[model samples]
Target: MKTVVICAGGPIDELAPLEPYKLSDEVVFIGADKGSVYLLNEGIIPTVAVGDFDSLSSEEFLDLTNRVASVKVASVDKNETDTDLALIHSLDFDPQQVVLVGVTGGRLDHFISVLNSVYRFQKDNPGIQFIVRNKWNEMRLLTPGIIKLTTNPQLPFMSFFAFHENVEEITLTGMKYNVSNETINIGSSRFTSNQLLDEHGSISFSSGICLLIRSSDQ
Candidate 1:
């Protein structure tokens, strides 16, 4: 498939354009536990639902089962969280890109755990593109390679950080704070909050991983 969107049961203030995806037959939607109810409330039916679903009430769970054709319920005592299981299920469709929504702005513990899962997924599946986005921010995990991005109207500000030790030969072009072959280490805030200078921007590195963030002020 071209794209798959996974909606988790996290707090979502606003969601980006889903009408287009809803109309198109190529896009797949997977709901993680209570996210199924969230999807239905938004007028989009999930193709598949997967989770332990401890968050849902008995009535809600029955309604969900009745609404969605496919439901994979898990044991509440499982190792992975509902979001993680939902993510793994999404891979069955083998989408070119996976956009994660409603996966942020919840419990701090759940947020951090989901972030770690996303990072691990990126590392394991370097060929596929993964994006985590909400109303205010968009995030991507970058492995060693060059990535070019165009200006985003909603999220104009950009930031880059080393995900591992010694992100070597880092270079940035077409940005406010352009760099050339500089190295940055984990926990360093040297490349934070850089804005785009023009229509396009690029980042490249020889080794290590990076977390690229596109965000806007609320």
Candidate 2:
């Protein structure tokens, strides 16, 4: 089944777009403390809530315990971050796709860490599709394949970053600005932000991994 695992980090500001995509049976909420309050406020109860309750008040914690189907509480002193643990648990269900929400804002460190974790998961499980969505942008990790992207006119910025050393034979088509037979390496910001010319664009890489960020100013 297609499951969207919502991580309990960052601000839950862009959750409206995600409402229609949520499946009652397949939705999993990883409430990292106060995130439970966000879910409750939205009138959506999580199927499984996992996190340390440090960010929530006693009453909020109690409310989540009562409302959620199952609660997996962790210690404040755990090796993995709450979001990491949540992602691991989500994978246990063997979902077709995992979309992480409320995971891209606030502290810069946390945001980078979450993106790194997504790439790590992609490396580990090549078949699974994972994405991070926010109000302004949608980010996904790509590995050696052609990907078709449909542009939202409101959100015209499309960028690609090579996460590895040898990203070879990268090509783009249908974009206002295209790259051809390019080698995008780590530490290079050459492909930072570009505009989409058409309704759709495509990207292909012969080797290595890249992170694609499709964003908008408005």
Candidate 3:
């Protein structure tokens, strides 16, 4: 599969509209734990399901296994979380893109864990693009390089932050709040809420990791 979309077991209210993804034939859906039931509820069947499944009843687990072609059940005590396991499984296919949805609006601990995991996986698999998406936000981690993006009308607000340390020589062009050769430090809010001045905008950082988030009010 060129694109693998993981429906995680986060709050359903936080998930991006699933109907669009369900209608797309190009995307492969992977359900993580309770996410399997969520997908089924939305009339989308996941090809694979991965999780410890403590969140599901015995009957529900059985139903999911029967419906999904590939089911991977792990120990509840395992070190990796259910979402992380689903992400690992997604990499087995070496997809060009792996998107994570239904993951950003639940527990704070879980969200932070997923965010860090995405950062780690993105660094490890530079060829694969990892994304965290929700009802109103899309996030991606960029290493030291230039990234050109077409402005999304739905998500006009763009924000960049240093991953853990200082990001040096940061540059932003074609943006409403353009900056040049700047430095963004950890815990800095200087780059928040910038919009694209044109149809396209560019971001470049010479050092450190940058986290880019495009968001909307909705």
Candidate 4:
């Protein structure tokens, strides 16, 4: 499957752990105003650099234009956020999966907006997979089906949260905490946190939507 990486302007420290997985050709750097600096430091030339660039000096903006293949400048007055513009551009590539890096670990509003965008994309295209990755966590949305989780062996905590309605008929296997045919609804906080018992675990639900958050404190 074709994969595309969207690099937004956020805390670079949170993304350091992900360096090993970075591939030059598959990345699309979204400047998000000041994010262009981070991309340049990593030696990544963005396919498309976007945002109103209000945070950048004229020199920096000129540097960004010289480095990237295409620079999409928007007005700071636009309705959609910089990240939103980045996502929209990524979709144009018809990628099988989109992985967002440097998207979290900063302002709560931006993080929440990015989360909402993930759900919005899922609603628009049910089959495509979208994931947000930071130093500590990997978040993905699930519709209705079985989700198998094998312990990373490196990072061992797995958690689930309901994004839409509660997830119904949820079942868990091979975990320290187990749940069977239970409903995980908003305000329930039933499945906020769980641990992996064996090397692997599986989750299945009959209906509803949820976000499977696999994380490690390290």
Candidate 5:
């Protein structure tokens, strides 16, 4: 399966560790705007760079252009953000999984936009594994389906939130706070901070989208 990892123009240092994904040949990396600078600095060359690149200095932009073989430059006045452009570009690669890094911990507006964006992205493109990962959290959006998850000792806390207006008939097994046919409405916090009881767990829902967050205390 092909995987696309997008490094966006957020706090790069806050992204989850990169080592685990570096060795995979199936993974393609793309840099969005200032993210190109971070990727180049880390010695991780991008398959392509996309964005208006307004955040980068002229010299840094030049350096990025010189380093990357393919660069898609968007006009500064474009309506969509750099990360949006990057996500659109990612679909062309026909990736099985798309991991978004450096996409959190920025402006409040941007962070909120990203949250909505991921849900719309998943709804538009079903069957694709879309994830947003940072130092403390790994998040996934599930749409009315059965999701099997393995317990990660590193990330001890697991939480679920209703992404849509009403997520119905929700069920969870093999978890510390298991539920059966429960309904979670949007803006509710009842399902937050649950734990995986054993090596694996399963979550199922009949309707509406669910946001699953796996996180660490540290």
Candidate 6:
């Protein structure tokens, strides 16, 4: 699948190592601001670099330009955050999936901002899948449909929540806690930390969005 991975400049400890992503097929990397430095440190030259880049030192910035293929600079005072800019640019490839990494941790507001962007993008382009993955969590938005899931041995914990409103006609199978024709209302914690009973499972819903989070114990 065609995928665009946007790396933001969040806390390094919170960000998962990019080595695995570098080996994915048909993947393009976008470095937002200091994210370029982070990618370069891991020996991955980004296809494009987009952001204000005020956080980088002169030497670091120079090294980024010398290494990365393209750099799309934005104003520091621009309305979009670095991650937001990266998201916008990611659509240029019309990728089948947009994966965001290094966007969580450090400042909560920044993480929320990226999530708001993800919501908007998911609404605008329903065909492309949007994902936000950090060291401990992998988050995605589930629209009204039947979604097949596979167990992630590394991320054994899974949680689901109603996105904006109550999700109706929910049916789950192959899960430890299966439900049928149920509703997950806003602020419901009933589905938190559920596990897949088998290698595969399914979640079917008819209305509203669901936030699916697969987490690791770490």
Q: Which residue pairs in model 2 clash with each other?
A: none
Residue pairs in candidate 6 whose N, alpha carbon or C atoms collide under 3 angstroms:
none
Q: What TM-score, over all chains together, does every model reach?
A: 0.95, 0.91, 0.96, 0.91, 0.97, 0.96
- Tens digits of per-residue lDDT for model 4 on 1-218? 66667778787788735355455455444555566667777776667788888878889888888888788889889999888888888888888888888888879999999999989988787767898988788899888888788888556677787786888999989988898998888867667668888777899998888888878878
How good is model 2 by TM-score?
0.91
Q: lDDT per residue, candidate 3, 122-150, as tens digits?
A: 98998889999998999999888888989
Comparison by lDDT, 4 against 6, better one: 6
Each model's RMSD to truth, in Å? 1.4, 2.0, 1.3, 1.9, 0.9, 1.1
Best by TM-score: 5
Candidate 6 per-residue C-alpha lDDT over 61-180 given as tens digits, one digit per residue, 9 for 90 to 100: 889888877899998788889888888889999899999988998999998888889988998898999999988899998889999999999898889999877889999999999999
What local lDDT score does residue 189 receive in model 6, on the 0 to 100 scale? 96
Full candidate order by lDDT, most accurate first? 6, 3, 5, 1, 4, 2
The list of candidate 2 runs beyond 4 A from truth reads 14-16, 23-27
Q: How close is candidate 6 to the true structure, as a TM-score?
A: 0.96
Return whichever of 1 and 5 wins on lDDT: 5
* Total backbone collisions for each predicted model: 0, 0, 0, 0, 0, 0
Off by over 4 Å in 6: none
Q: 24-73, model 1: which lDDT tens digit per residue?
A: 78889999988888888888889999998898999988988998999999
As for candidate 4, its clashing pairs are none
| Whole-model lDDT per candidate | 0.87, 0.79, 0.90, 0.80, 0.89, 0.90
